[model samples]
Target chain A: MSRALDRTGIWIGWAFFADLANALALTFGYMFSRPVTMQYPDKEKWLPYSRYRGHHFLKRDDEGEIKCVACELCARICPCYCIEVIPYEDEKGNRHPAKFEIDMARCLFCGLCEDACPADAIALGQQYEFSSFSSRDLVIGRDDLLGKPGKAATGGGVVSARLNTEQDVLVETSEPQGYNWWRNIRRT
Target chain B: MELVVALGLIVFKVALLIAILLLLPLPLTWLERKVAGHMQQRMGPMRVGWHGLLQPVADGIKLLTKEDHIPAEADRFLFKLAPILALAPPFVVFVAVPFGESVSVLGTEITLYVSNMNVALLFVFAVIGIEVYGVIFGGWAANSKYAVLGSLRTCAQMISYEIPMGFAVIGVVMLAQSMSLLEIVRAQADVWNIVYQPVGFFVFFVAGLAESQRIPFDLAEAEGDLGAGFHTEYSGIRFAFFMVSEYAIMLLTSVLAVILFFGGWNGVLVPLPPLLWFVLKVAFFVYVFIWFRFTFPRYRYDQLMAIGWKVLLPLSMANIIITGVAFL
Candidate 1:
């Protein structure tokens, strides 16, 4: 009986003080600690990674010429079938795309298009904020893909000026051929 | 003319108190979310307006606009009455709550409280006891098994906890030698009751958590098992009413705890006014409530009963005996 009473006393003491102390300690610890939220849209605006695949853009050569041989490899390899490359013979007898359209509404952003491109013409750009008002606005045509200067796409797809800022920072240095391809395209 | 003027003053005071009672929950809900968020190392709401200051406003509007859904087999009259029943008890309890010392305004001494009863403690307990009926009725009228089970749990939890809670108060009443909340505050002018009856205070605080059906004791509305418990069938503004009452009772108990233990509005060597001191004390207890909700996991139903019965009740009874002997 005495042992039971002693055990009860110990249990009660532990329950009262230990629980209160633990709660108070945790509360104060959390109060003093820095909040972990990123406060998105305003602060911490850096892109995720160098190789992070996002919106697709068509490349231009140093002389302001389209580099795509319109091999249709991207269209073939695309799991979502979002890319369409219509190859036609140009005035220089070189096969180029007459129309390059990517239904971004269907894009998986898998970076497969970038990997499959033989001429290094189509590459994924680092732009993730792409909410569109309509599905039609999501379809990127030849001029939009070519990074033309004037027309602003309604969806938060990266514009030419913004793309220029991200170009040097995001392109992987290990891929010398892709890096040189991107460098030559931006010179004009 | 004097009678008319007194009646008018009473009416005005009641209206003002009702408005405050109704509106306090809006900001409180937002505060609870923010506190819970910060405690967990995450920011709660930041989208609606400047750090989600307008979140409660948005929530109020959304609740108001939602379809008022009633289950097909529900007892419509009882279902409709339950939310109002839940809401009324807290306001009634607040009538006897003395917030601060009287101040003379325009040559008329005005008390901050709505009504000062000689048996204020009894009045608070009796009115608050009626609140469980709302839960039970809400559950029974819903005609669902989960709702019935939830209300049954609540009924048992609340009824069991009230014993320890009442005993804790009895210890304080014995110490103060008065039942009036105002008089209790006055008794603690020299020193707070918490200094004398720390055990009583601890017991009361724990019991108060169960009484308010807060987390760790919130088996009634345990989302995992009962699906929002008693208020499962309630929707839209009706659901908002139930939620508001839960917060109101929480505030009331915290305020009561302040008056009972912390010496409401009584501060030494403080330049701040008595009302501010009282409010700050109440706010501290309220923060503690939110902190506990965030930190502790919910208690299993049997463990909750065991704590209330085998732990708090016996402890409070011992505290009363100790206080009585010390007084002798």
Candidate 2:
């Protein structure tokens, strides 16, 4: 933003002082400013807001059991045909999935499955970090998708959390982290 | 017996100076990275050792342990010697750099400096000028085109800037009426040379930046282009030597500026030890040099030439004339 061939004494003094002052001010300003990087699984784990369609989580009743009625509405609505469900009746007349399978590799992470669930049992929850080693791991079964992993999927927008190393989960702290990228990505 | 003791003292001083010079680059590396990081609104280096305090030491260890790689077509002899040549002059330059006046220890006086010849200022400049050969040799020895170009740029840049850098100090020399750096400091006991020769100080600093191959004027080893410049083919300890010498040159510039313009060992406000004042002033000047690295952009080759010859050269020349007229 400066010029060359300015041999005037006044120009030298003004340019030098002005530039120095500007640089010093900026340097000091940034020096004290906070960095906008997420530590992630080191110091703080990110908690995606509600309505985020990350990994699938089966909704639970008050007693913390699956709310799925084996209605097969989610299987019918899935665009990718990634879900499979087999219906059976309990002695109490409650309906449940005898064989439920989801091929995560083929799933598009669309919220249609959550919307079509009449029982409000199946949902694409905000549990994003579910990456595993092999193709077999991508094909999750009832045991894999049952209990909601990590923190309770109930926070909004953005949250920071202390890492729970032993169970490999996030312990949400009271600090109240702020930033939002919820549903920023959409599947056409 | 007396002569033996005198010779022993000289050897002891040389040993001490070398140790200090070798260790100087450790904290300097940490400071430069830390400053650059903070200015850019990021944590600089925190992993290695608390804010990367042990980073340079770790770097030195890495360099030391790395395989010594040499290009197949390179001049092997010159390649080995270049780093030593580059490294020795800055070490030698310290001979004339007076840290403080003689301090007595148990009835025996020991000078803070290794040696102080009457022509100490001249000696310092002349020795520093020789470091260009080290850089030139490094580039030429590598037998690479980019290395050659980098070396040539270094040679030309130093030659052009050296004139102004040398002349900038003439104002201080004239005002002090002595070429000895110690005497120059003594002359500025009450009033610093910076008051009389602001232009000279400016010229000296700018030219010194160029001389040291610091960031703004660091065309020789410009990391962006030319594949790391002259020391491109160099690796391990040899490359580390070049790096250390560069830091040493920057340190020398700060030390010289303090001795010449800012009044070395002369405290302003509070009463403190002379060495402390000298160190504190030198530290401030060194920080300014690092500040310039992060603050300003690198100059284009032609722009570098223009600044060196057109602006600084003439400014320093005019400074000399003005100082002469004022003296007369």
Tens digits of per-residue lDDT, candidate 2, B113-180, equal: 87778999899989988998998999999999999989999999999999999999999999999999
Worst 10 residues of 1 chain A by lDDT: A179-188
Residues forming the 10-long window of minimal summed lDDT in candidate 2 chain A = A179-188
Candidate 1 at B169: error in angstroms?
0.7
Chain A TM-score of model 1 comes to 0.68
Q: Tens-digit lDDT track for model 2 on A74-187?
A: 989999999999988988888899878999988998789888988888777556666666878788888777754422335432222333443444545453432353333222
Reference interface contacts recovered per candidate: 0.56, 0.47
Off by over 4 Å in 2: A1-17, A34-42, A49-55, A61-141, A150-172, A175-188
* TM-score for the A chain of candidate 2: 0.66
TM-score of chain A of each: 0.68, 0.66
Q: Write the per-residue lDDT of candidate 1 for residues A21-136, one digit (tens) a residue.
A: 77767865785555666644433344334455767778888888898999999999999999888989978799999889999899988989888899888887766666677999
Mind sharing the TM-score for model 2? 0.84
DockQ score of each predicted structure, in the order shown: 0.44, 0.45
